[model samples]
Target chain A: MPETNKKVLILSVNDEDKDIVFRPADTLLGVLRGKLGLTGAKPGCLNGDCGACTVLVDGIPMKSCIMLAIEAEGHKVTTIEGLINTKTQASFIKHFAFQCGYCTPGFIMVCHSLAEKQPHADKAVIKEWMQSNICRCTSYQEIEEAVASILAEE
Target chain B: MIPVDFDYYKPESIEEAARLHEQLDRQKMLPLYYSGGTEIITLLRLDLIQTKAVIDIKAIHECREHILGEDYLVLGSSLTLTQIEERNAFPLLTSVSKEIADHTARNKITLGGNICGEIFYREAVLPLLLTDSLFVIGGPQGVKILPAHEAFQQTMQLGRGEFLIQTLTRKDFLGMPYMSVKIRQQWETGYPLVTIAALKAKGEIRAAFSGLCSFPFRSKRMEDELNRKDGTLDVRMDRALRHIPAPVLNDIEGSAEYRLFVLKNTLTDILTVWEVEQNA
Candidate 1:
């Protein structure tokens, strides 16, 4: 703990700013799931290609897998755990936007960010933003319907 | 697949970053500059990047300058792709940046990373290629600004400890009508086999492409030929392709034959856009 103190980071996650220790090259996805015990962001591809580990940094959707935990210092990061009781998560639940539930957190994060950017996101923008979060079970239509519903509510 | 352990440092100034880079190079640690961390993590996981130390340059203020000067726009290297997309300051650039990847990755990927990123899909560079953009490279000797084309082509030519600071492009170029396009067999998220960008500037059509050749480039002569409307559009495209000897990227996303067809289609599509714009 003393040695890792050299890599100590104070990050704002889910409206709570906490001090966390992470390695130099450790990804935010790893730190969220491994150390802090926030398993909301999934580690699907572990590359920027797959958006399964999506989170909101400073209120914008980002792939946590490609972002270093050390780089996340002093930034606001929001995961699916932060989405508890939110309308977007409720929409996902209602529309059955998950099969295995691995990609649900990431999809919810993306939709949440989309709503912030475009409070009433049209179909084109929703279609464009959902491309990164891949749903292997082919539940994309339901997910899109969920996101569109969230937008409609806004 | 975890990347090997590395040390991270965030320098506050360009001089400090350059000094750190030079020091690391002397120690044979193979230091890599990092900003946004999107490319750094992906390449590291793939074992493509084997550096011992990673320097996060986002802390450097000099590299984060995004300003619209009277004549040019100084786009900071650390500006995220999402920031560039939302910046209605450059509408064509906005659309192009949005098409780069998905919204999530865009939030993590930076403009400088996309430009100096060591990847095949440096699609954002196409617009800068069409304009007279120059790169301000910082090193121990000092900050030396080089034309964007020469800097991009001669990245290996950069001296030790040298890195790109920011880009300066004429602000008026952003106002010129341009079309940024990509032909990806896979929908939205696929790396475009051939990303084409063409703009009408100074009363002449200029064009650039990525993924069609070994590197991102443009063809002024091809733009001229496309504008001529001589009965040889198809023949001219074929000849121009052969002139540069465009090499198709034969990868999982596309085959060489498919890439060639995409390049041809992209160039022809630009001509059609040009025709429509000319009439309008």
Candidate 2:
């Protein structure tokens, strides 16, 4: 029998341990959504251009599609599912930050990290952080408001 | 996701990384060094490159070092663009890197990855070229230090199995008066129409360019023309434009003619800003 290249990856996703078999070529987005059933990170563009698959790796926002599953071995992978009831989520609801709801998870993850990292984020800083994600629905105004409202509370 | 499976090895030291590359080559594994892996992953998705194995060099200590020595600032190749921005060890580098990609993508793009990448618009190398930085490379030939300009032509000219470990810039160069600008086609989110970085050292203006041509470059003739005290800024800029190293790039981002037009304005802006600063 030919030796299989697949290996067991013990991942810490959403503060839980998951041991899943994966190939080295599999992306973090693929493993999270396909293997672990953590489908919150949508695979839009699959390239790094779109932030639909944005997730927090050790509190820093990363595009999951570009990041390999093996790279997430020693780090804490936080998908939108990991985010329970958070201020960014609440602010998104309050501000109506979505039209089609496809980009909300990715935007929420980025905004959530921004709120934690820069609690006093201003307009410039907010724009710098939020520019990574794209919303085809043109809901950037409401998304900006949602992020601004959360940062204001902080 | 990459369509094909490849063996992944994480090497702890430069020697180990080099050895893995050699061994993988002997086994016909077609190994490639991985750091940041943003470009590799992106290109892999498009079927642009193929590899049977990958050596992840991020675990090597020297490749992750970001230190400020008394005489130099040593930045590891694997250090992410975001890390560089947050550290801001070299203000010019920070400014140039800030405009490379959107904020989140910068979190994964690294110094070595940007410089050694197949992507033509290697905007990060502009500041390094202006500073005359040194590259620390490791491979089957062992580690050696080489001047960035000598080893980097259009791309990093590395021997087989070699990879860039770190970049060392003179501490004095870090604080020099500098300007960096990136002009995009439409908005700030996409790739650049033209990106220019300039630094004034010892009463001379040194410049490098990207997106204006197929590859990033620093031309001696262009700098000489720009620095000539005999001509006005407009004349000097026109002369410099004539000496551009290659045909201006014309792609989806911009046309060759439009790129030259934008490059002229950006160069004028740099000169104008620096002129005021120098006089003050």
Q: Cα lDDT of all candidates, in order?
A: 0.80, 0.91
lDDT of 2 by residue, A44-148 (tens): 998888899999999999999999999999899999998889888889999999999999999999999998999997888899999999999999999988988
lDDT per residue for candidate 1 within B210-232, as digits (tens), equals 77777788776666665565566
The alpha-carbon lDDT assigned to residue B265 of candidate 1 equals 82
Q: Candidate 2: which stretches are off by over 4 Å?
A: A1-6
RMSD of each: 2.5, 1.9
Query: On a 0 to 1 DockQ scale, where is model 1?
Result: 0.54
Superposition error at A71 for model 1 (Å): 1.2
**B149-206: candidate 2 lDDT, tens digit per residue:** 9879989999989999999999999998888888998987778998888999998999
Candidate No. with top TM-score? 2
List DockQ for all candidates: 0.54, 0.56
**Which residues of candidate 1, in runs, are more than 4 Å off?**
A1-5, B154-157, B227-231
Best by DockQ: 2
